[model samples]
Target: MHPTVSGSGRLMLGFQYFLHFSVMGIVLPYFNLYCFHIGLTGFEIGAVSALRSAALVLFSLVWSILADRYSARKPIYILCIFISTGIWSLYLFTVDFWMILAITLIYGIFYSPVISFLEAFTMDALGVEKTRYGSIRVWGSVSFIAVVILIGKIIDLYRIDVILVLVLLGASLQSMASFKIPEVKRSRKHQAFLFPITLFRKEVIVFLGCAFLMLASHGAYYGFFSIHLESLGYTKTFIGFTWALASLSEIGVMIRSRTLFKNYSLHTVLVFSFMMAALRWGCLIFFRSAFTILLSQCLHSITYGAFHMSSILYMDALTPDDAKTVGQAANNAVTYGLGLMTGFFMAGALYEPIGAKGLFAISGIIALLAGAIFQTMGKRIKVFPP
Candidate 1:
């Protein structure tokens, strides 16, 4: 039977997005900053970020394989949610670099698959009305904006360590909500024992390569943007506002996803997003004024919001029905996992030598390069035939 999602199922899925991203709002802006405050060097923080991404590369695939093989996506999804939450609590017990690094790896093993699994579920749940994905996915951006704005002020009022408690609480609640996720029954016809070779099609490969570079270009921003802000003498509240602003723009694009995709090809949106990322990072390289910074932040509507939705939809279009979970897992692994891993390590290694401004310059170049290569090759090679 074709998969079907009920109203309550969609509600639970939206709740999952909110809770998961709310925790992300905490970690993305503050976790590395917390490390910095506690005396971890730039390299150490980068290592932590890269290692977690590495876990995503390896483990997301493993979990997806099992889920596809056993048809137990719900059970596996719930298991990872709870286990990762439990592991994250270990952060409260130690601040030592090595110990924290170890914890990050273990936590990442469980945490890595959660988002990919969630994406697969969302895609499956959306079913025939998948174009409305933006409506459901907007919940994540909503929670993210709210948390970053709220936590920024709270951090100004209290200790940075408070982030740990808030993240734990958010995750704990997410774990509880995981129980509400309705099981999605995939068609047995999609059941397969081997990875579909179509996954290696020239178009898919080219697309993934371009996507990899696009995300890799974000390494400096995601890994060090908060630190960059603080180094510029911006307050925690200001940093929070800046991050929240990005998500706010992201929500605008996401809210318009259905219309955007209907009017433009996924290929066009991806290319535009890549070009905008280059421009956005270039702005960061030269400007430090609040107005300029905020202006550039708005480009996130294209850079991340449009790029991400396009990438997901593109991969869905390319993959075989049997390998839906695996396709999203691969997308997450290549872009967010390996791509971010490379970016984090590069940023970490260079942060001390070149600083955040220098890192932004390099990131801009990487993004431009990705755009050029994809633009030229996509058309010449007929990667996305109309």
Candidate 2:
């Protein structure tokens, strides 16, 4: 059998995460704000984001299926990155909402699967060292913090239109870095086990359901947090700082992920994250002060950092070795795709009628419900070894 990826390859993996998420750092915080600047309606913004999420679900699955079927994850991955980078360049030529939405949909077709595939590759490369994923993934957070803060300041000095350029630059670098990713070949014996029936245990279903709700609750924050801040009269720099703060807090949890998972059960971490998510959103419902908002951002340590790492590890343990790509794909599709799509649509539809405050209230309730149901149903789940 071919050996697992070595130390240099792991470093390449870290670099890949850094570059991939650098683009995310641009899009996540500022892309919608860019849309707002161009006079897109709230619903139109939501439609763009929601359709992109839909592409994540549909296209990511198709890519993963091909990856597993042909044992060609790396080639498929590289192709997607290059193609998506090319697609994203089309943004420069248009400010029309319909054109932008179409571009987002096309871009999503190639962009959606990149992360899930990277994650699956990461798990395979790490082998027994999976728990340390946070350390490597932490590089993404670092780049994210840097980009958001820098872009925020840049936007204050210039136009929001710069976001389009920055995203293209980041994505182009990611495509170049994609060539160095190490391939992990599976044994012929394992090839026969793709998408086995046993992959969908009740525990997996419950965890995924809870994960979906958790991400769904993030709809308001991801889709419109910058616009919400602007509505509150905050400057672009401050809005960027707020987003950077969340990622900064997320870094701490990720750095200590090995210790954290060793001391607490995934069940415990997941429930606590949900509880923190509820509290975080609930705070936004009543407070608008800078201090309060930054404090709320700190809770991202639990809400996203701990919860995400645990979800990845849990899914890795549950999936069979041969089916790792599809396993991660399913996880991504369910949480980021379906969950975020629903949340974005809900937030978009309701933003005009109820505003950000009302959206946060609904989000808090959704988070609480996720925690409650998971705590009750997830107790029986077996904790995988870190």
Candidate 3:
């Protein structure tokens, strides 16, 4: 309905989403399998996986701060993509566990910046009619499903090493897309040492903490869920399809997030998202039935898709334009980088003793705790650019 938001803007956002998620599909469904194929143990894989998040903890804040200061988003996004794709491609040559971990560590530092900036850029492109964001982001979910299914078929036929080839191709395409995206210049000029942490209000801190807890809960799933499925006698292809099904559901939810957000507050969405995530993981722990798992996976819409969209919108609505990119980045730093690193490490160390059942149960509990925390922060937390 808004003039600033256009079909063209949606198209550009969708294209960007496609590249970002396609890269993810290639990595998520296959990376752990590749690690196993090369001789890493479950513990080692968990450690290596955590290394990526650990690196993000170190660098995500710095990158987000840069985007806040610079205002030119596209160039920094491109640099991160090129770095991510380049280092992750190292899998083709290395079988050493430490080497793989090293690659993951380096890749995450650069890769973490893209999504944070891209969210800010896309919102700028959309302006008042941000309703279109979900429609555009759903394309990413759809592309992810397509790639996961395609790569699953390939893994069914060929050796797991073939995954690296797909990953390389995906990253290359993403980098090219990043290059083609036109830059959006922000109007607000920020001070050079505008450290947001110094000015972060209680609400922002609470929101960031809740987001961190939610992502931390996903640590087991993102780092090792694929491997867990395989360990449970599920084939790589079946595991891939599970991921695909979840994405399909996510796409559906994404298309409706605009309407959903219109009716609900951002805090309400976040609380609901974490509650659903708790349910999703809790259900996963109890039912190994394929249909049950499939249904639970579908709830990923509420769990991840809704959670992510709401977080960004909340950040957008609450923060100043000058601090928008930094806010997103700070959330990522704490959530993906720090929280994920912590989750993966805990999940890794605890995996063998607890098994998949116990691991997912913990994830569920954490989600519930996050939801409770968010509820407590309600109406009391400060909302702002400071």
Candidate 4:
């Protein structure tokens, strides 16, 4: 445990995660629906979504460098929350494709650093027992389940525009919560003018490559899963339930992540996560029945829950203390930024002619390839024991 972080502080951080992910649950899973509601075509929506990642790729490194240079994670985080909230609010007034694309790009620049800084804060607070991250992070999943279900019903009864109100509310609460977190102290020495290119050793490169492949595989699901379900005649309520089911399953994996870490190497866990992702996407290719969809979602426990936690721990172990924030930004830039950009753009182009089924089938194959690449890491990658 970090000497400065009290138990109450930990609880507050958990609440922050809860608030942040609540906003994500409302917006992320359904933003495509909102785009469609505002009259954008599938290709335009994908371009808008891809623009967000492009901004992240462009700006995350700049923000992370500033955070590390000034040792000001909390200040950067609070400013990002306010800026992103204001920019995101513009969505309510804009129906034009160009306008939405511009807003999303700007919003992504500010939003990119939020999670990376939070990860750095949380890891510092956890100290040596980094695996406990999942315990605190699981609250995010809980809030996601609650908000997704609630917003789904709200959209079902009212209109998708109501999601904007909920998103703004979550952002307001998150900004307030940011003030409660104590500023974490770190060494200001060894600040580099440029990110250390040498950090990309053979092992790190392989890990990041596999991570990119896995997230790229997720492009179809994240960008179009809800629309796909709706197209198949599933009700909004049922679609929300499926999302909640995945989060609920994620909670189980998160709560038990420490035990899993104790029993398995991070490499082992991540390889398994990749395999499960492959299987989950494979199932989506052939089976769209409610039961099969829900069953496939069960794999979220490993695909996201385990993969995310393990990746953070792995990165924490690999990077120096002074460079943690920048390290995390690099990881995010590769996995969520560039990787997701490729996936969204490709899925968008493929969605019309190839369809969701075909897109996911390709995703499954990519995930399998990612797993194979990770397997080659073998004993080269280090795993921290619980």
Clashing pairs in 2: none
Query: Candidate 4, which segments miss by more than 4 Å at Cα?
Result: 1-4, 384-386
RMSD of 2: 1.8
What does candidate 4's lDDT look like per residue over 95-150, in tens digits?
89999888998899899888877888888888777778999999999999998898
- For candidate 3, write residues 167-233 as lDDT tens digits: 7887888788776664455564773355554337677778888888998899888877888788778
Candidate 3 — worst ten consecutive residues by lDDT sum?
1-10
Q: Which structure among the candidates has the greatest lDDT?
A: 2
Clashing pairs in 3: none
lDDT of 2 by residue, 1-386 (tens): 11368889989999998998788888999999999889999999999999999999888978987888778889999999999999999999999998998999999999888999999999988887788889889999999999999999999999899999999999988898899998788653444246654346787888889989999999999999999999999999999999999999999899999999889988899999999999999999988999999999999999999999998998888777777788888889889998999999999999999999999999999999999999999997766623
**In angstroms, how far off is 143's CA in candidate 4?**
0.3
Q: Estimate candidate 3's alpha-carbon lDDT, on a 0 to 1 scale.
A: 0.79
Model 3: residues with Cα > 4 Å off, grouped in runs: 1-6, 197-199, 382-386
Report every candidate's CA lDDT: 0.88, 0.90, 0.79, 0.85
lDDT of 2 at 177: 85
Candidate 3 Cα RMSD (Å) = 2.3
Give the RMSD in angstroms, all C-alphas superposed, for model 4.
1.8
Candidate 1 versus the native: TM-score? 0.96
Residue lDDT tens for model 1, 236-283: 999999999999999988888899988997778888989999999999
